[model samples]
Target chain A: MITQQDFEQIQDAIAGKLSADEQQAYNKRLSTDSNFAEDAFLQDKLKNILSDKPFDEFRGTLMRIETEYHYLGLWRTTETSETFSIEDILAMFEPVAHYEQALSHADLRAAGTALLQPQNGSNFLPNDTLTFAWAAALTEPLVLSIENNQEDVVLQDTIETGTVSHNITLPNLPAGRYYFKLTGNNSGMYIGMFFVNKNLLDEL
Target chain B: MVTLQQTQAFMNSKHTLNSNEQEKNTRIIDGFKNNNTRIIGECYAEMYPLIVRYITNNSGDETTAKEIIWECFEVFFKNCTKPDFVLNAKFSSYIHSIANNIWLKRLRDNKKYTYTDITITESSRHDFDDDTDNPYASDIDDYTDQITETIYENDLSHVIRQLLLELTEECKTIFRLKHEEEQSHEEIASLLQISIDMSKSRLYRCSIKMAQAIKNSPYYRELIDGFPFLTNYTNKKRKS
Candidate 1:
């Protein structure tokens, strides 16, 4: 039963646009007439509902970022690479650990590898200092190799025997996944991976 | 593998973060308060591992960890946006505490898992308990209250937003201009290349349609039923 005029008056009153006399009249009708009061109340609620544009926009941004994260394989199951082909795993930035687990059990025992830092499938900023460690008792020299997804060696280093750990300050690597391999003359090779996320760097 | 000394050393490392690290924390908190997408994404990347580690170490899995973290972020984001909100701890620590609380509540609700008392870590415990450092020392209660209010408002807004989408494109544009941009009818008419009268009439018609739709909705009826003051108006409308 509220007319266009009534609705306009209610909006004007809510916006505090009504003149002194008009405001007084609107207040009287609001107190005396339940219908008008209800209309006004609903109008006020509608205005509030319409003002949620910022929240709606924020949710849109969150969804976009979530989709990007999912595409980066951040939300994948922590299963070993046994479930996926090498090509399938390599196609995305897989954050799985112990890629060597994909090898046969005999190769694993023969490797006699020590614990490695970064445990594979971890994310790091470009400027982060990574600690690469291996077993200390081995007398042979170890070669540390880091390769990009394209199989190009981006970084390589040599470690002398008796060195348990080496700290390397990472270069400003672009955002993507990179694989690192540690090969000892007498021990098994250790393969691990990490991601240099530009988004994390930009945000920080 | 983790000894008490190692844990203490790790905590000490956190406290002794370099100036750049402290600056990074400040930027993250500022960006979070401002709703920066890049910062939010960074938060996910940095904190997700900690959440997953904690959840997996307890009685939860990756999927449950994801759900709880998302829910905690939603609530945490809302709380951070409040004008009076003051975070006394690291942003990550605050969110981790929220995730812990939410996971514990979920476990308690499911009742299948035996209630194991999960202790809050040292950093988070200090953040939660120290009133001098934390402005919102009683934030658990505040968060609960805000969450309830957010649920109600979000539900109502979501329904209204869906209905608004059902409107004609022109009607939607008019609503956006009038409500969001606060454009007057004259300005709207000028922008839309329509007469002022046409602009005014279209807006009025749109508003009426929205009002009628809301009035007939089951959600609106439920809302009114819960609010006694609104129920008085419903009773009068019924009598009329």
Candidate 2:
């Protein structure tokens, strides 16, 4: 029977905590006593079993990806002509930027207008052409500005009124959080945020 | 952070046929071995479409395709962890081969689908053989053997996780503190409101209980029987 003291010694030996004299005695006993060696091996295995963080973490990631894919309607029951682009797949794994925190004090929507396309907190690859759309049309020209996380304007454009949607080819920008705001002269302002990730594009 | 145009130009210029292939393969293998999530995610994104296409061609749906691909990844990742493991084929080809085998086996087992009815293309057979080079034939066999061993390991891990769930809440907390949180005995004692000696004793006792549970598990017995070198202690203890 292994006593607590014996178990403690085995743990110490496995951890390399024993003094020089104790280490020599432990080695001698390990070579001579089969039970002691067996106990030591078991303790080592137990330590491994307890500290399997990598396996656990990998498994968690796999499950999370699977669930995200399922939620994204990637799994199909029958053959469909539609396929996901690399950007679409990578966006699913990108961390969400809570851009709402930036607009908490400001009004996000105008009185009758709604921002659509490139949903809030969406991710985009640099230089990709994106269609920005809104529901309501104001008579005055709308000023559109894209700002980086530091609130510095990166791209500025003026959208002619009567058109609810405008196609803008995003300029090459560094990978980080960005917010776009649409302001009308008389109408209130509409704001949304997105992320530019260059890493995935490079991988592609 | 290069401009997008510069990055594209660089990518186009950097594509040397042989070196690029070798570098990409090395990166993928290392990524899987190290459990790099970004690399794995890239692999998933790249291979998922191919697997889905192959499965859909073989009278399988995307749901089955997803299941088989994930299972292949588990086996492949486990094989990558083995010290002697080698990848003789492209990572995508190996994964495709594993997914093909798994899907075919499933089809064969199901009463609705017959082996003859399923189409096995010439290219897929070549991939399944994974015998592009004559010198690496034995390594291909090793891949198969490793897959089998990895399946068993996956089962054993599942069983172990289940056994962990059987541990008492207090035992689980103690384990999390010691192993996951890497807490010292004094810290654990302070958190749990117990003496340092008691904290140490509790951890030791919990480990002993876990060891006993693992030894008594049927999966453990099966693993030991299949791989006798795993433990001589069981046989010696039986005799003594």
Candidate 3:
């Protein structure tokens, strides 16, 4: 739970605007407090993403394409290519997820992390319990977060342990895809995507 | 501030695409238009590690490196979509160079990456900080200025703009003013001719509708799921 003041202090620290004592305190928190460190990393990420001009333009344009993609390629039955079907869109998204997982392999290799169950492109029932596993022998905790496309964090927490697996009973998760990012110890970031089928995943 | 044209020109001028390369460029553009994730994914797989290595080798932390690599991806994708866009060199090399350029800018602004052995290359040279480009005459200028304002100031995505469009016109105005313009609720209320309390209520309503829309829209469902930033914002907002 990052307060507004923590947000400001993190920004100030990132900007090098903090006074010596302030900087010292911030640095102390970064090293000793896992939550503080995660918050700092998240804040820095937001700042970098928001500060970029050229990239946002590209994203905006690509989204515009996405808004109209169904109208092209497969749905050109009539003059209005603007029309879209959900199934067609989902089909198109398949490769997007595929490639994303492929790209993530690089980072996962670097971090020595691998997502086991609900693997990329794998389907799971909405009601089913999900198990997330990673390969690790860490001296420090790692922050695992599941985020939506809107850049919002749905599930996030610090994973503290030598144990390498986590089993979670998802609370009626909305059906769709999600990005899971694992970060800690200032080593490397491991990113991947998974899908939740709208069909009720049975809790057996 | 960079106009879209100047940005295009700066990018296109960097490399001269041969006739064969032009067709390949077209295919790449087609790939993006068709949501050909394989091409983009391939680029990311090959390029992300290169960037990570570059960033960690310098004074930067892994966090900053991930940010820069994502930035490079965005820039590369955007450049691929431009009307006069070209790939004069190898796609991997081009994006790698752009990543290099982005990192140097990051280092300059932060003054944190005090590198001892990294030699600056031609790709490291960029004038993103320069404010020389000017918008031209007429309503085109107005539109261009609006875009310039959005890019240089707002730095948000089209998805957000689309979300705001889901609101009523008045609510949209209030949100644009409050979020992008950074206006106070009092100011937004004054400008919109609504009470301060009403302004807050409308903002709250707008947020709810916005979230609902993201949840409902399949376009967003497929996208938002894979994007951490959007979900994080809503999750944090829900907590707040």
Candidate 4:
């Protein structure tokens, strides 16, 4: 079993604190004993880590900071004021939309809404109940509204469960490009569009 | 609505830190490490609205917003102390990613979130950045394992630093002066209003306590038992 002395010896050897004669002896043990060699290698890794001044400095800074917190009694709430609303905390981040993508005119209508059932530009019967998809899983009920090219609301309904996908029936009207908007409980709005197959209706 | 240009400008500004800017960043980082409540509070207050908007805009209430935002703050503070950490962007953007991931994970857990074949918006794409260095594919818990690993692998020195920080006030001061600042026992004693002999002995005891803590750590136990180096090395040797 490796004793404390073995550990010390390994550490010293790795740090080059061992004398030439002592180093030679340490190397001898490494060549002779496999276990000692493995321990020595580990000690070497530890030595490298320990000697990292930048890392150690960072650690020292953290310790001082932690200790400072202890004295300040800031572990809980502020002594001077009442706890504030959490929404106030978000101000620390610079308000920015990092997610922005240029979209085609058709995709622009969808406005980056998650779509599952109706493929964009696909032909659908006017009387069909098309399955709608949204990328976000919202617990609150949402409103699904469909409008024609003239921006007239054709179908508007409330879905109780913001399931991954839901079926929404279309109003039997002239086949044309229809834009859809999905809005959840203060969650914001997402949009997409689908086409009513005028030719398919003619065939029928 | 922060644009990509704004984000690039913020990150780019970090490369040009004047003395005041450097000092301010240091103070903020130092305040967090030390748990200066005022600094932390102000920071929390500032970040709260952003978190609230994100959560509220996604069907969440204030309570849910508070829990996720606070958790993200803890992670953000710890991340700031990472050695040689570069300020690559507005720290808010980084926090934004973490908070968003946590909420997304929460939604998935409650079965409110689902995957679809639709194209992702810029908002979802911005979530690719992670602050915690968490390697997990999904944005959720298993945080206890990570906490242990952080002390062991990612921040062993920092763990020791924390342990030292947790010592009694006298011990903390004496140990910091003695070891970190390399102050002579006489200097420490005079500065802290203690006898030189007392200072020496206190430093000694504090060192022993730290050593004990290290030895008692589960990571050290595994290391001592040859679980990592020894077993692996022996197996490799045997194979060879």
True contacts recovered per prediction: 0.30, 0.20, 0.05, 0.02
Give each model's whole-structure lDDT: 0.65, 0.68, 0.53, 0.55
**What TM-score would each prediction reach against the true structure?**
0.50, 0.56, 0.30, 0.29
TM-score of 2: 0.56
Docking class of 3: incorrect
Docking class of 4: incorrect
Q: Give the per-residue lDDT of model 2 (tens digit) for B53-119.
A: 7777677788888988888888787777768765755577667667766675566546467668866
Number of backbone collisions per candidate: 1, 0, 23, 25
Clash pairs, model 2 backbone: none
Supply candidate 4's per-residue lDDT for A145: 88
Candidate closer to the true structure by TM-score (higher is better), 1 or 3: 1
Best first by lDDT, ranked: 2, 1, 4, 3
The alpha-carbon lDDT assigned to residue A198 of candidate 3 equals: 27
Better of 1 and 2 by DockQ: 2
Q: Residues B101-183, candidate 4, lDDT per residue (tens digit)?
A: 56654565455557442222344323433333322222223233333323234334434545556678876676557545758
Name the runs in model 2 displaced over 4 angstroms.
A1-6, A17-42, A73-204, B1-18, B33-36, B48-68, B78-88, B96-139, B142-151, B184-187, B229-240
lDDT of 4: 0.55
Candidate 3's C-alpha runs over 4 A off are: A1-204, B1-23, B113-240
> In model 4, what lDDT does residue A40 have?
57
Docking class of 2: incorrect
* Whole-model alpha-carbon lDDT for candidate 3: 0.53
DockQ comparisons of all candidates to the true complex: 0.14, 0.17, 0.04, 0.02
Please name the candidate that would achieve the greatest lDDT relative to the true structure.
2
Give the candidate number with the greatest TM-score. 2
